[model samples]
Target: MVLGTSFHFDGQGTATAADAMKRYCGLLGEQEMEGKSSPQWLATKELVKDDGEMVFEEGISRFCPNCAKILKSAVEGTYPRLI
Candidate 1:
Protein backbone atom coordinates (compact mmCIF):
# COMPACT_ATOMS: atom_id res chain seq x y z
CA MET A 1 0.00 0.00 0.00
CA VAL A 2 1.05 3.55 -0.67
CA LEU A 3 1.11 6.43 1.75
CA GLY A 4 -1.60 9.05 1.30
CA THR A 5 0.51 11.83 2.76
CA SER A 6 3.90 12.82 1.48
CA PHE A 7 6.75 11.20 3.39
CA HIS A 8 10.42 10.70 2.77
CA PHE A 9 13.58 9.09 4.04
CA ASP A 10 16.95 8.15 2.55
CA GLY A 11 19.85 5.76 2.85
CA GLN A 12 17.81 2.81 4.04
CA GLY A 13 15.59 5.02 6.16
CA THR A 14 12.02 3.83 5.80
CA ALA A 15 9.03 5.80 4.62
CA THR A 16 6.80 5.18 7.64
CA ALA A 17 6.92 3.91 11.18
CA ALA A 18 5.45 0.56 10.19
CA ASP A 19 7.97 0.34 7.43
CA ALA A 20 10.68 1.12 9.94
CA MET A 21 9.46 -1.69 12.12
CA LYS A 22 9.71 -4.07 9.22
CA ARG A 23 13.28 -3.05 8.58
CA TYR A 24 14.09 -3.27 12.26
CA CYS A 25 12.80 -6.79 12.42
CA GLY A 26 14.17 -7.73 9.02
CA LEU A 27 10.81 -9.17 8.24
CA LEU A 28 9.28 -9.23 4.81
CA GLY A 29 6.39 -6.92 3.95
CA GLU A 30 4.13 -9.97 3.73
CA GLN A 31 4.85 -10.89 7.36
CA GLU A 32 3.41 -9.66 10.61
CA MET A 33 5.47 -8.36 13.53
CA GLU A 34 4.16 -11.31 15.59
CA GLY A 35 4.44 -9.29 18.78
CA LYS A 36 8.09 -10.14 19.04
CA SER A 37 11.33 -8.22 19.25
CA SER A 38 14.42 -8.76 17.16
CA PRO A 39 17.56 -9.75 19.00
CA GLN A 40 19.59 -8.09 16.28
CA TRP A 41 17.59 -4.94 16.78
CA LEU A 42 18.00 -5.04 20.51
CA ALA A 43 21.74 -5.45 20.13
CA THR A 44 21.94 -2.37 17.96
CA LYS A 45 20.39 -0.31 20.71
CA GLU A 46 23.66 -0.68 22.57
CA LEU A 47 25.29 1.75 20.20
CA VAL A 48 25.07 5.44 19.50
CA LYS A 49 24.50 4.33 15.94
CA ASP A 50 23.46 1.39 13.81
CA ASP A 51 25.99 0.62 11.11
CA GLY A 52 26.30 4.44 11.02
CA GLU A 53 22.93 4.60 9.36
CA MET A 54 20.29 5.01 12.06
CA VAL A 55 19.52 5.53 15.71
CA PHE A 56 16.68 3.61 17.32
CA GLU A 57 13.82 3.45 14.83
CA GLU A 58 10.78 2.65 16.89
CA GLY A 59 11.20 2.52 20.59
CA ILE A 60 7.93 0.78 21.32
CA SER A 61 5.72 2.95 19.14
CA ARG A 62 2.81 2.58 21.51
CA PHE A 63 4.80 4.45 24.12
CA CYS A 64 7.26 6.68 22.28
CA PRO A 65 6.46 8.85 19.32
CA ASN A 66 9.91 10.32 19.77
CA CYS A 67 11.24 7.17 18.17
CA ALA A 68 9.94 8.21 14.80
CA LYS A 69 11.46 11.64 15.16
CA ILE A 70 14.72 10.15 16.37
CA LEU A 71 14.86 7.97 13.27
CA LYS A 72 14.44 10.99 11.05
CA SER A 73 17.23 12.76 12.91
CA ALA A 74 19.48 9.76 12.65
CA VAL A 75 19.14 9.79 8.90
CA GLU A 76 19.30 13.55 8.50
CA GLY A 77 22.16 13.94 10.97
CA THR A 78 20.39 16.48 13.17
CA TYR A 79 18.89 16.73 16.60
CA PRO A 80 15.52 15.09 17.22
CA ARG A 81 12.59 16.00 19.44
CA LEU A 82 9.51 14.20 20.72
CA ILE A 83 6.10 15.24 19.51
Candidate 2:
Protein backbone atom coordinates (compact mmCIF):
# COMPACT_ATOMS: atom_id res chain seq x y z
CA MET A 1 0.00 0.00 0.00
CA VAL A 2 1.22 3.44 -0.87
CA LEU A 3 0.82 6.30 1.57
CA GLY A 4 1.30 9.82 0.36
CA THR A 5 0.12 13.37 0.74
CA SER A 6 -1.16 15.32 -2.20
CA PHE A 7 1.52 16.00 -4.76
CA HIS A 8 2.29 19.69 -4.80
CA PHE A 9 1.80 21.42 -8.09
CA ASP A 10 3.17 24.70 -6.69
CA GLY A 11 0.35 26.59 -8.41
CA GLN A 12 1.17 25.06 -11.76
CA GLY A 13 -1.77 24.04 -13.87
CA THR A 14 -3.27 20.68 -12.98
CA ALA A 15 -2.37 17.61 -15.02
CA THR A 16 -4.18 14.41 -15.90
CA ALA A 17 -3.07 11.37 -13.88
CA ALA A 18 -1.26 9.95 -16.87
CA ASP A 19 0.53 13.20 -17.48
CA ALA A 20 1.46 13.62 -13.85
CA MET A 21 2.91 10.16 -13.44
CA LYS A 22 4.76 10.40 -16.70
CA ARG A 23 6.40 13.61 -15.62
CA TYR A 24 7.10 12.40 -12.10
CA CYS A 25 8.66 9.15 -13.22
CA GLY A 26 10.64 10.91 -15.84
CA LEU A 27 12.22 13.07 -13.14
CA LEU A 28 13.30 9.92 -11.33
CA GLY A 29 14.56 8.23 -14.46
CA GLU A 30 18.08 9.65 -14.61
CA GLN A 31 20.23 12.39 -13.16
CA GLU A 32 22.06 15.09 -15.15
CA MET A 33 19.43 15.96 -17.65
CA GLU A 34 19.40 19.07 -19.77
CA GLY A 35 16.48 21.07 -18.45
CA LYS A 36 14.83 19.21 -15.59
CA SER A 37 15.86 18.81 -11.99
CA SER A 38 14.41 16.10 -9.76
CA PRO A 39 13.91 16.56 -6.07
CA GLN A 40 16.90 15.18 -4.20
CA TRP A 41 14.75 12.90 -2.08
CA LEU A 42 13.15 11.32 -5.15
CA ALA A 43 16.48 10.47 -6.68
CA THR A 44 18.03 9.01 -3.55
CA LYS A 45 18.11 5.26 -3.00
CA GLU A 46 16.24 4.16 0.11
CA LEU A 47 15.50 1.06 2.09
CA VAL A 48 12.18 -0.40 1.03
CA LYS A 49 11.22 -1.73 4.44
CA ASP A 50 12.40 -2.86 7.84
CA ASP A 51 12.75 -6.56 7.20
CA GLY A 52 16.39 -6.86 6.22
CA GLU A 53 15.81 -4.77 3.16
CA MET A 54 18.55 -3.28 1.04
CA VAL A 55 20.34 -0.45 2.82
CA PHE A 56 21.11 2.78 1.11
CA GLU A 57 21.45 6.00 3.08
CA GLU A 58 22.50 9.09 1.35
CA GLY A 59 21.90 12.21 3.39
CA ILE A 60 18.23 13.09 3.45
CA SER A 61 17.44 16.16 1.44
CA ARG A 62 14.09 17.85 1.07
CA PHE A 63 12.52 20.52 -1.06
CA CYS A 64 12.27 22.73 1.97
CA PRO A 65 12.43 22.71 5.75
CA ASN A 66 8.69 22.29 6.11
CA CYS A 67 8.61 19.31 3.83
CA ALA A 68 11.44 17.66 5.67
CA LYS A 69 9.63 18.10 8.96
CA ILE A 70 6.43 16.68 7.55
CA LEU A 71 8.20 13.74 5.99
CA LYS A 72 9.95 12.98 9.23
CA SER A 73 6.67 12.88 11.10
CA ALA A 74 4.91 10.75 8.50
CA VAL A 75 7.72 8.26 8.20
CA GLU A 76 8.08 7.94 11.94
CA GLY A 77 4.38 7.42 12.31
CA THR A 78 4.00 4.80 9.59
CA TYR A 79 7.24 2.93 10.14
CA PRO A 80 8.03 3.36 13.78
CA ARG A 81 10.31 0.37 13.84
CA LEU A 82 12.36 1.54 10.92
CA ILE A 83 13.41 4.83 12.47
Candidate 3:
Protein backbone atom coordinates (compact mmCIF):
# COMPACT_ATOMS: atom_id res chain seq x y z
CA MET A 1 0.00 0.00 0.00
CA VAL A 2 2.43 2.60 -1.09
CA LEU A 3 0.89 6.04 -0.69
CA GLY A 4 3.29 7.91 -2.95
CA THR A 5 6.69 7.80 -4.59
CA SER A 6 9.70 10.06 -4.23
CA PHE A 7 12.89 10.72 -6.12
CA HIS A 8 16.52 11.06 -4.96
CA PHE A 9 19.90 11.84 -6.41
CA ASP A 10 22.49 9.18 -7.07
CA GLY A 11 26.18 9.96 -7.53
CA GLN A 12 25.54 10.49 -11.25
CA GLY A 13 22.81 13.08 -10.71
CA THR A 14 19.92 10.65 -10.99
CA ALA A 15 17.30 9.84 -8.38
CA THR A 16 16.90 6.36 -6.90
CA ALA A 17 14.50 4.76 -4.44
CA ALA A 18 17.14 4.23 -1.75
CA ASP A 19 18.32 7.81 -2.08
CA ALA A 20 14.75 9.00 -1.87
CA MET A 21 14.23 7.08 1.37
CA LYS A 22 17.39 8.57 2.84
CA ARG A 23 16.32 12.06 1.87
CA TYR A 24 12.90 11.53 3.38
CA CYS A 25 14.35 10.29 6.65
CA GLY A 26 16.84 13.15 6.72
CA LEU A 27 13.95 15.62 6.42
CA LEU A 28 12.70 14.26 9.76
CA GLY A 29 16.11 14.66 11.46
CA GLU A 30 16.74 10.90 11.70
CA GLN A 31 20.23 9.66 11.05
CA GLU A 32 20.35 8.31 7.51
CA MET A 33 23.67 6.49 7.79
CA GLU A 34 23.31 5.25 11.40
CA GLY A 35 20.86 2.42 10.56
CA LYS A 36 18.02 4.27 12.26
CA SER A 37 14.38 3.79 11.22
CA SER A 38 11.21 5.83 11.45
CA PRO A 39 7.63 4.67 11.83
CA GLN A 40 6.62 7.02 9.03
CA TRP A 41 8.41 4.70 6.59
CA LEU A 42 6.09 1.84 7.40
CA ALA A 43 3.23 1.23 5.02
CA THR A 44 -0.34 0.75 6.23
CA LYS A 45 -2.97 -1.10 4.25
CA GLU A 46 -6.60 -0.04 4.43
CA LEU A 47 -9.82 -0.87 2.65
CA VAL A 48 -11.82 1.68 0.77
CA LYS A 49 -15.55 1.49 0.11
CA ASP A 50 -15.11 1.77 -3.65
CA ASP A 51 -12.65 -0.47 -5.40
CA GLY A 52 -10.71 1.04 -8.30
CA GLU A 53 -13.13 3.86 -8.74
CA MET A 54 -12.68 7.61 -8.48
CA VAL A 55 -15.23 9.46 -6.38
CA PHE A 56 -15.65 13.11 -7.25
CA GLU A 57 -17.77 15.70 -5.54
CA GLU A 58 -18.48 19.30 -6.35
CA GLY A 59 -16.15 21.77 -4.63
CA ILE A 60 -14.46 18.93 -2.74
CA SER A 61 -11.37 18.93 -4.95
CA ARG A 62 -10.87 22.64 -5.14
CA PHE A 63 -7.31 23.93 -5.58
CA CYS A 64 -5.69 27.29 -5.21
CA PRO A 65 -6.50 29.67 -8.03
CA ASN A 66 -2.86 29.89 -9.07
CA CYS A 67 -2.41 26.15 -8.83
CA ALA A 68 -5.55 25.54 -10.80
CA LYS A 69 -4.32 27.84 -13.52
CA ILE A 70 -1.00 26.06 -13.59
CA LEU A 71 -2.68 22.67 -13.74
CA LYS A 72 -4.89 23.83 -16.55
CA SER A 73 -1.84 24.93 -18.44
CA ALA A 74 -0.31 21.53 -17.82
CA VAL A 75 -3.41 19.82 -19.12
CA GLU A 76 -3.15 21.92 -22.26
CA GLY A 77 0.42 20.67 -22.71
CA THR A 78 1.91 24.05 -21.94
CA TYR A 79 3.27 23.05 -18.51
CA PRO A 80 4.43 19.83 -17.00
CA ARG A 81 4.39 18.62 -13.40
CA LEU A 82 7.90 17.23 -13.79
CA ILE A 83 10.51 18.88 -15.88
Question: By TM-score, who's the top model here?
Answer: 2
* Higher-scoring candidate on lDDT, 1 or 2: 1
Q: Per model, how many backbone clashes are there? A: 0, 0, 1
lDDT of 2 by residue, 1-83 (tens): 11121222335764433343444444444433333223333322222333101111111231123234323433444422221
Best by lDDT: 1
Candidate 3 similarity to native, TM-score: 0.22
lDDT of 1 by residue, 1-83 (tens): 22222223345544554445445433312222233222222333422433323224333343345345444543454532222
TM-score of 1: 0.23
C-alpha lDDT (0 to 100) for residue 66 of candidate 1: 36
Q: Could you give candidate 3's per-residue lDDT for residues 1-83 as a string of tens digits? A: 21122232335453433444344333323322223222211111101212201111111122222233322332344532221
What stretches of model 2 exceed 4 Å from their correct place?
1-8, 32-40, 43-83
Model 1 clash number: 0
Residue pairs in candidate 2 whose N, alpha carbon or C atoms collide under 3 angstroms = none
Candidate 2 Cα deviation (angstroms), residue 43: 9.5
Can you give the lDDT of residue 43 in candidate 2? 26
